[model samples]
Target: MQAGSPNTRQSSSPASKGGSARRRTPRSRNRAPQSPSAPKPSLFDQVGVTAVDPAPFDQLGLPKALVGELTKAGLTEAFPIQAATIPDALAGSDVLGRARTGSGKTLAFGLPMLADLHGTSARPLHPRALVLVPTRELATQVTDSLKPMAKALGLYVREIVGGMSFARQADMLRRGVDLVVATPGRLNDHVRQGTCVLSAVERTALDEADQMADMGFLPQIRELLNHVPAGGQRLLFSATLDGDVDRLVREYMSDPVVHSLTPSAASVDSMDHHQLDIAAEDKHDVLARIAARDGRTILFVRTKHNADRLTRKLRSVGVHAGALHGGKAQNARTRILEEFRRGSTTALVATNVAARGIHVDDVSLVVHVEPPADPKDYLHRAGRTARAGATGTVVTLVTDDQRRAFRAMAGKAGVKPTATKVSPQGANLARLTGAREPSGVAVVEPKAETNRNPGSGGTRRGNPRGRTGAPRNGGGPRGEAKRGEAKRGARRA
Candidate 1:
C-alpha cells in the first residue's frame, strides 16, 4: 500500500483488529480498482482567474491622457502581462506579477501607479509612488520608459541611484518629485540622510524582485518597504518567486492577487541555445570571429576584469567593442550603452550587470565566455538577446574541463542545447554567428593627452620648454630655489 494512503491508515486503526481485517472476500479484492483522477492545474496555470485576452489599451480603462501618450508612442495593444495585471492594478489591488524580462512589465506597473497619482498632490521630499529596481541601469531604463507618460499626467518623475551625484538627487527630492524610481541602496542612503521620505507614498512596486533577492538586497528591500505606510498598495514582479521573495510577500503584501504570464522557470521560446566545445587555445579566435560579424553581440564574462580584458582583445582585432561593468563610472557606462544602441559599438563585453536591465534593440547574438554560476543568471544573460519577439542565438563555449559543469548548468536551466565540437575555423561557427574574418590590423588606442586636451598633444603653453614641449614640474633650478627661499624665510620669521 502507498504510504499515507487512506486505506493503509484505516487498516491500522483499532476497529480493523476485531477480525474485520480478515473478513475481506476474494471477490471484493479481485474487483477492478478505480482509476486516479487527473491532477489539477497549478495556480499559475489557472489563467481563467485573472488572465484577460489581449486587447487594446483602451479596454483596460487607462486614463485618456495616458492612452494618448501610449498611442503617440505607437503602442496600441497590450502585452499579456499588461493585459493580465493592469485592470487589477488600476483597481487598487495589491498585485504579484510573474513574467520574464522584456515583457512590458515597466508599463504593467507604471501606468496604474501614474493613473492613481494623477492629480494627487505630492509633498516636498515625499513621492506618492516608488519603483525600486536592483541596478542603476534598470532605474534609468524604467525612468525613460515612464517619463513620457508621467509628463502627460503632469507628474514629475526622478531617478535616485548610486554612482551619480547625490546632491543632485537631494535637490530633486527637495524640489518635490511625484514619483521616484531608485535602486534600494541609493534610496536607503537618501532615507538615512533624511533627504527623502516615504510616508506620503501610496503605491510601491518592485521590479525583478528575484534578482534583488539573489543579489542579497532583500534586507535593504525590506527596510525600504517598511518606510511606506503599512496600508499602501504594494506590487511585486519577478521572473521567479521563492526564498526571500516569499518572505517579502508574507511580511509586506496583504492578500495580493498573483498573476503569472509564463511558468516560473520558463525559457524564452525565441532564443536558440547552443553549446560549442572548442580547444582552450582557439577560444579567443573563435570569439573574435563571431564578434566581428555584421550585427550586434553581447559577450558575458565572469568578472569585471575579464570584461575589460576581452573588450580590449576584441578591439585589438579591429572589432568595435565596449566594456560594461560596475567598475565604470555612471556617465561612461551610459555612453557605452548609448553607443551600443546607436550601432557605433556593435559588440559589448559585460559582466552580469547588463544581464537584467540593459535592453537594446536587435541584439543578434549573446556569447557566454564563462557559464553562469546559477540557472537564473543564465536566463538573464540569455535574455539580453531574443527580446520581445525577436529571434536570436545564445552560444556557450565549453572547454573540455568545463563541459561537465556546463552540462549541469544547462540542465538546471531547463535548456536542451545543440552541442557540437567546433574549431576556430569550423563552418558551424561561421554559420552560427554569421561569422566574418576580423581585420588583421590592430586598432590604434588614442593617446590620453589627446583625449584630455583635444588638440594639445601632451603639451601646454605654461610649460617652460614652450608650447610644443612637455610640461615641467618646476620651472627650473631658479624656480626651485625661489620655493626653497620662501620656506626658509617663513621658518626664520
Candidate 2:
C-alpha cells in the first residue's frame, strides 16, 4: 500500500478481513518447477467490476483477530479500491489495480495478503510474502501499516532497504520473517549476497510499479520475482498501467483482476489550482511570505540544492522549515519528516522524492517553487495535497519565460488554473496563499541528529568490518591468497 491519503488510510481495509492459508516450503530460486495448478492466461486481459460498494471489515474473509485490530484502529470499512479488489484478491486471483496515492491501496492488498500468510510460517531467510516498493520511505510506511494487522494474525514482517543496517536486516531474515518489505536495489543486493531468499514467496505485491519502471528498476524487479514460483498470487498496484507495467502484467501476472479508481493522469478535483506570474527577483520574497503562512505547507523545488537553499532562506526569516531530498542520509530524512509530522516544522521544502508516500493531515497548501516539466510530474506534486476529500490549494510559481510551457503542461493535466501576476507583499499573493511578511529574525536550523550505532547507514563505528560486512581483504579465495602473500613477505623481511 502507498499509504494513499490520510482519510483513506483511516477508512480502507479488508471487508471480510484476512485469514491464514496453507503453507509450502520450496528451496532454490527458480529451481523448483512452478505448480501445475497456476492459471495461465492466453491473452493479456483485465476484468473490471463497476458494482463495487464499500463493505464492513468483518464480512470480507479476514481472520477474526485481524478484523479486531482494524476496528481498534478505527478502520472498519473498505474504501473504493479495497472494496473493488479485496474479494478477488482473497480468492487467490492475480490483481492489477490503478489508483492515485492516498486512495488507501495499502490495506487493500495488505489485509488480504496477511490473511493468506497467517497460517504459513517462513523458513529462515525466506519470507512467505514479498512487497517491492520504489523508495525506502514508502517501504517504511507500508511496513508500519501492516504491522498491527500482521501481529493479530501472528505473523512477522520486516523491511529491507538502503540507508539502514545491511547486517542487521540479514540477521533478522536469518532468524525468520513472514513478510518482507523492500526496495528493488537493496533487496537485490541482499539476494545476491545470500542474505535473503525469495523461493518461498507464495504471494508478491508490487506497489508503485509505474514509478519503479520510471526509475529503471524493471530488470532488478524481474530478477527478484523470478525467484518466486509460478502460479503464486501476485498483485500489482500502480498509478498508471503503461509500457513497462503492462509488460510486467503480461509476462508475470496470470489473468488479473483490474480495479481503477480514477482515470489515467487524473488530477485531484478538490485542489484549488493557481499560477502566479512572478519575476525571478520577486520569487524569493513571495516564497518567504508563503512559507510564513498558517498551517502546514509543502513547497516543491527541482533540485536538492534548491531545497536546501530555500530552507535556509525561510529559516533565516524565522520560519521553521525543513529540507528533504534523496541526497540526505536516511536518518536525516527520517528526522526531517518526523519533525514536519509533529508540527515542530510547519514548512517542508523538498524535491520530487516527497511527492509519493508522504501522507500527513491538514497539509492545506502545496506550492510548486519550480514547476514540473511534465503533466505526470505536475499531477504527482499536486497529489501531495487535496487528498481524501479535503480541499487544498496548489500554486505554481511561473516566470515569464516558463509561462507558455507551464500552461501547456497544465492543460495536458486537465487543469485550467487561475492565473495572476503578483509581487512581494501584494494583496493578490496575500489573498491567494494567506501570505504575510515573515518575522525577519534568523532561527538557527537544527542540525541533523547523529546515530552512534555501527550500521544505521549514516555513520560507522570502530570496527574492522564496515557497512557491507565484508572482510578486510574481501573474505574469499582472493583474500586467502593475499594473506599467504603477506606471510611470505614477512618471512623475507
Candidate 3:
C-alpha cells in the first residue's frame, strides 16, 4: 500500500507523541497555529473511484508484448496513478496528474506514448514523442526506464540534457530518434541549433512540472510547448497543481483528465521526522556518525561548498561518502551517483540538486544539515527518503538560533516531529543513527599529476621530493627520491 493512504496510518506511538508534546512552550504561542484540517479531496475521490483497487495492466488494453515485459520486470500490478491515467493517455487525451514522488507516474505516461508510436516511422531529427524533465539525472533515469520498453516495441529513445556533449547529442538526433527525453534548457539549445525539431511530436509528457516551475523553467517550458504540433496530446504530472503549475495546465492542457492520488504533504507519512537540537560545534560530529551507519543516507546541505566539505569530513572518519551538486561536471556527477547506487558509497552529501530528481532505492535516512529556505523545499528534501512505501527517518539538525525559525517552517510543512536535545554520544543519536566509535584513520585523496614535460623524449616527471629528499609529511623516507633514483639507475644501465 502507498504511504499516507487512508488504510495506512503513520507509524507513531503514544510515547512519541508525549515526548514531543513536552517540548511545547510559550514560544508555541508565537508560532503559526496549524488548522485541524485534512487535505481536500481530489476530483477522483469525489467520483467514488479509489486507488486501493486498481485494475490490472493487461486489462488496460496494453499490447501483449508490453504486458509480458512488465510482468518480466515483476510489475504485474498497476499503481493507483498508473491505472487511473494510463487508459486516458492511451486514448490520446490530455492528462494532468497530481501524484507524490515514487508513485509510478513514469510508466503511466511512458507506456502509453510507446504503445501509441508502435508502428510509427521516425523522421531524422524529429521525435514522435517527448518527455521533458527538470534535471539531467531525471532525464537519464526516465530514459533508462523507458528504453527497454521502447526497444521491445521497436522504438528508439534518447536523452538530451545539459553538461553532456552537444556534438554527440546532435549526432544522435541526426541518426534519428523516436522518443526524446530532455531538460528544457538543453532542449531549447538543440532547437535553436536546428539539431532537434518538435514539430512532428504527436505526444508530450512533462514529468515533475511543479519542480520545473519551482526552478523557474516555466518560460522555457512555455516556449518549448509552443513549438510542438498544435493538436498533439500532452501529459503533465506534478506533486502539487497550484500557482504556476495550474497556470501551465489551464493554458496548455486541453480538457485534461485530472488524477490526484494523495495530498501534497502526504508523502511524509511513511517517514518518521525528528528535530535534533544540537550545539553548532557538535553538528559535524553528529552528522559524521549518522553517515557512518549501515544504510544508505542522503545528507542535504544548503550550499555546494558545504556539500563538498561535509563529504570530506565524513570520509576522514571512515564513512564512504560522495558529494553531488550542480557545480560538478556531468561525468563526475554520474560517477558519484553510480558509486552511491552500487554501495561503494553509502552516504551522499548533496544540495537541493538531488532533492527532486534522484530515485535511488533503499535510501534509509535523510539528514538536513541545514534547514531549507522554505517549507516546500523541506518537504522535497524529506521526500528523498521514505519513497515507494519504504519506511525511513528524516532528521533536521537545528541549532539553538535556528530552533524557532525551523519549528515554524516544519509546522507550515505539516510535519510534527519529535523534538529532543542531542549530544555527540546521546542515546537518541545512537538510537537514530546506530552510532559507534568512528574510525580514526584519515582518508587522503590522490591528486592528479600534471605532465610538466609533455614532449621531452619519453622522460616522465613526478612530484619533486621535499628538502630532505623525502616525500612530504613523512609519507615514507625518501620514497619519491628512491623512485627517481631507480629510474635514473635503469636509464644509465
Candidate 4:
C-alpha cells in the first residue's frame, strides 16, 4: 500500500519526474535521443529481463464496471502477469500464478474476485472472498487494490490485520463484509475467537504464498484455512511454488491451472544496477546526496535503528527522508508512507516491510544502504523500482568490510554491477541523480571503537565495538528482523 486509499487519485502519482500513467509511454517519444556517452546496461541489465506481454484486460473478459474503474484509475493496459492469469481466474478456475514482485499480481486475482463476488446485502454479511497475504503492508495494499471494484459492485471489504483494534474488526464483521483482505495471523485470531467466519467464503487467494511459507506463517495459514470449507475456490499466486507452498497446492487446491510468467529473481530489464566502492567514511554522504535527488528514492537499511538514524540524519542535512519498518505503529507507517507518496517526503528509508506486495509507482531509484542477505531479497528490494516497463536505478553501497558479503549477494542475485567510486559531491553523481548542486551533508567515517559505555552490550576484544546498529527508530536493519519476530508478526499475517 502506498499509504492511502485507492479513492485518493492524487496519491496515484509519484513525486518523481516520471509523469502519470498516461503521460508515461506517449511522452517517451518526445524525449531527446540518448547520447553515445550515456551509460549502457551492465550485466545486471539482463538479470531480471524477460519479454512481458502487455495486453488490455478486455482480452480477459473483466466486467465493464471493473474495466471502467481501472481506466478511470489510469491503468489502461493489463500488466504481463495480469494478462496471463486474469482469464483463468475470471473463469472461476483455481489459478496458480507465478510472477515476480512489481509485476502487478494484485489485480491478477483481485479483478476476478470482485467480478465474481455478490454484494454484502446479497451474500448475507460474512466474507464471500478472502485474500491472505504475508505482511500487514501487503494486506493493506491488496485491500487498496480491491476497494474501488468492491465499491463499484456495492460490496464491502475490510482489512483485518494486527496493531488495529480487534473489536473494531469484529464490529465491521458484525455489520457485514463481502471480501476480507488479511494477514493470516490476525485472521486466524479472528477465526479462533469466532469474531469472523470464513464458512461463507467462495473465493480464497493466497497472495505471495511463497513468502507466507518463508516467513513461517504456514501454520497460521493452515489454521486459518481450517475455518473455511475445503471446496471453495482457491487461487495461489507466488514467485515460486515449493516446500510447504507446493504442499498447499497438493492439499488445499483442486485441479488448478498454473501460470508462471517469470523466474524467481527476475529483476526488471530496464533497471540499471551500480555498485559503488566507497570507504566507510564517505558512504553516508553519497547516500544523502542520492536521496536528495529529484525523483522518488527508496533506501534500504540493514537495521531498524539505522533506518531511523539515517532518516534523522538525512532530514538534518535537508533531505526529506522518511523511515518505514515493522516496529512502527500502524498509523505511523501509514503516515510515513503517505508522506512519501504525496511528495512531501521524497525519500523513503525502509526494511523488507516495504519490499513485497507494496506498490508505489515511479520509484525511480532503489538504493541498498546496506547489502541484502540473498538474491531473493536483492530482487525484492530492486523490484521496488523499474516497474511497468519504466526505467529505474538500483545502487548498492558497499564498504571495504562488507565487500565479501556484497559479492556473495551479487552472485546470489545473479547481477554483476559495475564497480565505481562516487565522489561525495560530483558531477557524475549529479548527472545520474538529476540534481545540480551538491547536498549539504558531509561525509563522515565510522567512529573508532571506544569504551563509550561499559554497560552497552559490551564489545568483544577485537571485533566491532557496538552491537549491529538497529534500523532507524530503534529497529534493526530493514531485512534484519529475527526469524522469530517475523514469525510473531506472521501471527498478524
Candidate 5:
C-alpha cells in the first residue's frame, strides 16, 4: 500500500489547489487487465487470493483521523469486504467487489475514496470524488455513512439527488464540495446545467451496480463515466454481476482487482428461510398477526398501490407501519425511513423499487406478501433482513395457486425454504415468525397519508374529489378514502 502512495498525485498537484481541504488519490495500478470474458465466478475460492485475517481499521492504510473517527463510531475492526478491498483500492486499483448487502460495502469503497482525498483542496463545481447509487434513498445513506469520517479528515461531502432543492444543490456545487453522492439522473442534470464537472474526480464508485443496470440506468451511467478523465480510480460493488453490469466492467475498468466474499445467488447461513403455504382467505389475518408480533419487520409487496394498501391495513389493525415506494416524494421517503430506523414504525410495507439499497439495523424479519417476479427479486427481498452477519428469518407467503411458481423462483435463487402449511392462527405460523393477533383497532394514518393531489398522477388519477390538504409537499404516499379492515377487507374464500 505504501508503495503506491508516493505515486498518488492530483492531476493539477495538491498544493496549487485552494479552499475546503478535500482529498483524493490518483490512479496507479500496474497490474495488467484481465480478459473481459474471463470473469472469475468462483465464490468459495475468494477469487484465488489467499485468505486474509481481518485487520483493525487503523492498520488498513487509512489516515489516523479517519481511524479515530471510526473507532469512536464503535467500528474498530474492518469487515471482510472492507479488509479485502481497502489495500487494493487505496493503491488506486480499479476494484470489482461482490459482497452481500449490509456487508459494509459503503465503507469498503468510501474509506478509500476519503483516504485518497485527505489533505486535498476542492475546486468549484469539481468534486474530487463521486459515489453513484441507484436511488435517492441510497445516495442519502452513503452520504450519511461517510460524512462523519470525512469531517474528521477536514473533507466535505455533499448529497446531490432529486426531490431536494435544485437551487440548493447547484449552490453547493458552485461553492465547491469535496465529494458528491448522487443518483444518475439528478447528477446528469447538474452536469447539464454547468454546475458540476467530473474532470477533478480522482475516484468514482458505482454502488449496487447490478440494481442500476436492472433499473436501466446504463445509458446515463455510461454518459457520466465518459465525462470523468481516463485512468481515474474506479470501485464497483454489487451483490451480483449480470450481463449488463459485466458490460460496465469490460468497457470502463482496467486490470481490476476482483474480490468475491460469497456467491450472489446463495442465501446466507445465518438466515432462517421458510415458505408458508396459506389460503388466500387467511392471508390478511396471518400477515397482521406477524406484523403485530415483535422486532422491526419489512413486508414486501408487488406494487406501489399494494405497499400503501398493506400499510393502511397494518396501521388500521393497530400495527404502526409505513409505506415506502419510489413514487413518494424524496422527503416523504426519507421521513418514513427515519421512522422505521428509529423503531417508531414497527413495520415497513415496501415495493421492490423503494427498498433496494436500503440497510436498516436489527431488522429481525422479512415477509414477502406476494411472490416476487423473478429469482433476483426474491434474493433482494430476503436480503433486507439477515444483513451484516445478523441472524433473521425470511418468510414467503404462497397461496395454493402460487406455490409451484414460488418454488421455481426460490430454486433459481438458490434458496431451499422449509415448506409448511399454515393458517391464520396456526401454531406453526406463530412459532416460526412469532405471529400473534393484532389489537383489532383502527389507527388513523397521519393526515398527510390519507389523501393526495390529483396532479401527482398515479393510482389517484380520475378521482372525483379535488386535490386537498397539503399540495403533495412530500407527504405520505397512501391515498385511501376509508381505513377499511384490510386491502380487500380480509375476504373469505
Candidate 6:
C-alpha cells in the first residue's frame, strides 16, 4: 500500500467471471497422454521462453547502455509486454498496454526513457520521464530497475514517495535527476511545492492504472498530468482498463498503439491454484511445511496482527519468514523486502502489503492463509504468483468456516483451486505442489544474526562507506562534509 493512504480499495478479483472452474484440474487426473518417443521441441520453439525472437532494445532502438545493463541483470530476453510496447514507446508515440502485474512493464517504459533522455552539463532535476505508480514500494522498486540502466547511460533516477523523509527526497531532486518514479500523492506534494516540474517531461507512464483508479488516485493522477505538456508521449499499462483508466487513456493518450497480451481474467490461468483444508490448530504446521517446500513464498493474512504473529511462528518453526503490513515502520518494511529478495527469507507472511509493488525474481508460490474481504484483494494477492511468465502456485488455507468466503473470492478471480486436505505436517504438500525441496537450503548456511537493514546491502556490517551511521563527535561524516561543502564550494569555484 502507499503510505498514509486512509481508505484501502477492495480488490476486483476475476473469480466472479466464472473462470476458476477451469483451473482446478486435479493432480491425480492431470497426467497428459504419453507420446510414443516423439522428440521434444528445441529451446527456440518455446514462445515467451528465454530464446530471443526480437529483443526489446533492438526493436525499440534503445541505447546500447540500456541493453547492456539489462543483459548484466539477466534480463536480455523481453517479456511479451516489453516486446509489444517498447517499439512505440521508443518511437515517442503514446502507448496503451494491457498486461497483468509482473509482466516486465518497468523495462517497457524505462528503456526508452534512458535512450531518449538527453543529459546536460547543467543537469535538470526536472524529470524527462515520469512514472506514476500506485504504491511507495513500487516507486522504490521501479527506481531500482531504472538505477542500473540509468548509471549505464550516465543518467540519474530519483524516487519520490510518502512515508519517507521529504528532506531526503528533496535533496535527491536538488542533485538533479533524469527520471522520476513516484506515487501520485507524494509526486503531487513535490509538484505543488515546486520541488519538481514536468515542463521538460517527454515521456510519462502510468503503471497499474486499474489499481491506481481503484485506490481513488485518478483525480490526483489527472492533476499531475495537467502540469505536463499535452504533446508529450503517454504510456498507460494495466491488467484491466475499465472505468477511470479507460477515461484517462482517452483523455491523455493520443492515437496510442494498443497492446493487450491476454484477457485480464485469464492471466492467472498459467498458474497452479490449490485450496488446502487444514484444521485451525494445524494451520501453522501446514503453512511451515508448504513454505519449506518453496522457492519463495508470499503468505497472506487478513489482519496486521495476524501478519506479525504468523511471521514469528514461521520463524520459530525454522522457516525464514518476515512480516509486512501497514503497522511496520518504513525502515522495517524496506528491510523485510530486502531479506525476501536476497533469499535470506524464504517466505514473507504479509497482510495486503505484498499484494502490489514488491517484485522479486523466482517467487514460486503465494499462500492466502486468510481469505480477504473481496475479489480485488484476491486478484492483487494472486498477482504475486505467475510473474514474468514463470509458473507459480497459489494456495489458500481455508477452514470449513471460511469456505464460503474463499469460494466467493475464487469465483470472482475466475480460479478454481484444487481442493485437498493438508495433514498436520503437510505430508501431501510436496506431491500436491510439485515442488522439490528449495535448492539453496543445503548450500546456504544459516547466519547467526538476521541482516534486516535495507541500507546494509545485505551485509552484516552496515554500509561499507558508513554513510548510514551518524557522524563522530556530533560532526558530519566524510561524505557528508563533502556533500555539505559542494554547494558552498561550487559558488566559490
Q: What is the C-alpha local distance difference test score of each model? A: 0.75, 0.76, 0.74, 0.69, 0.76, 0.66
Worst 10 residues of 6 by lDDT: 1-10
Tens-digit lDDT track for model 6 on 1-493? 0110001111211122121111211122322444779753211121122211344444445666677777788777777767666655665556676667787888877876677774542144577778998777888899988888888878888887654555566667778777888888767766766667887776788988888877778888989888987777787887775657767865776655566665657667878888888789877667767777657888899876787677666666567778776544456678778989999888888876578667778888888888776777788888887777778888888898998888877888888888998775445767775433322233232233222222222111232221334422232122322432342121100
RMSD of each predicted structure? 16.3, 10.0, 15.1, 14.3, 8.1, 15.6
1-493 per-residue lDDT for model 4 (tens digits): 0111113212221122111111101122323467789853211122232334667765557667888888889988988777766665655556666776777888888887777764336343377789999888888888887898888878887898865656567668878888899887767766766667788887889998877888778988887776776667788887766668866766676545556566665655668888877778877788877888887999998777888889878877778788887655566677778878888888899988888667888899898988888777788789888876678988888788888888877887778787777677767666656543435664342222221122121111221222333322233233223322553555533
The true-versus-predicted C-alpha distance at residue 441 of model 5, in Å, is 1.9
Q: Model 3, 300-369: lDDT tens per residue? A: 9987778878888888888888988765556667888998999998889998889866899999999999
lDDT of each residue in 1-493, candidate 2, tens digit only: 1212223233434342222232222312322345789643211222322345677878766788988999999988988888777767776767778776788888989988888887778999989999988777788889999998998888998888766776788789899999999888777767877778888888899998887887678888888888887757888988766678767876787645567667665546888999999999999999999999999999999877788889999999989999887655567778888899899999999987788667777899999998789787788878888776678999999999999999999988888899999999789999999999999999886754432223532212342122544334543324432432453211100
Misplaced by over 4 Å in model 6 are: 1-56, 119-125, 292-294, 433-493
**Which stretches of model 1 miss by more than 4 angstroms?**
1-51, 446-493
TM-score of each: 0.81, 0.83, 0.81, 0.78, 0.84, 0.74
- Select the stronger candidate by lDDT from 1 and 6: 1
Cα lDDT over the full model 6: 0.66
User: Candidate 5 lDDT, tens digit per residue, 184-262?
Assistant: 8778767766778999987899999888887777888888998987668788987776778877876777656677766
Which candidate, 4 or 6, has the higher lDDT? 4
Q: What's the CA error at residue 449 for candidate 3, in Å?
A: 12
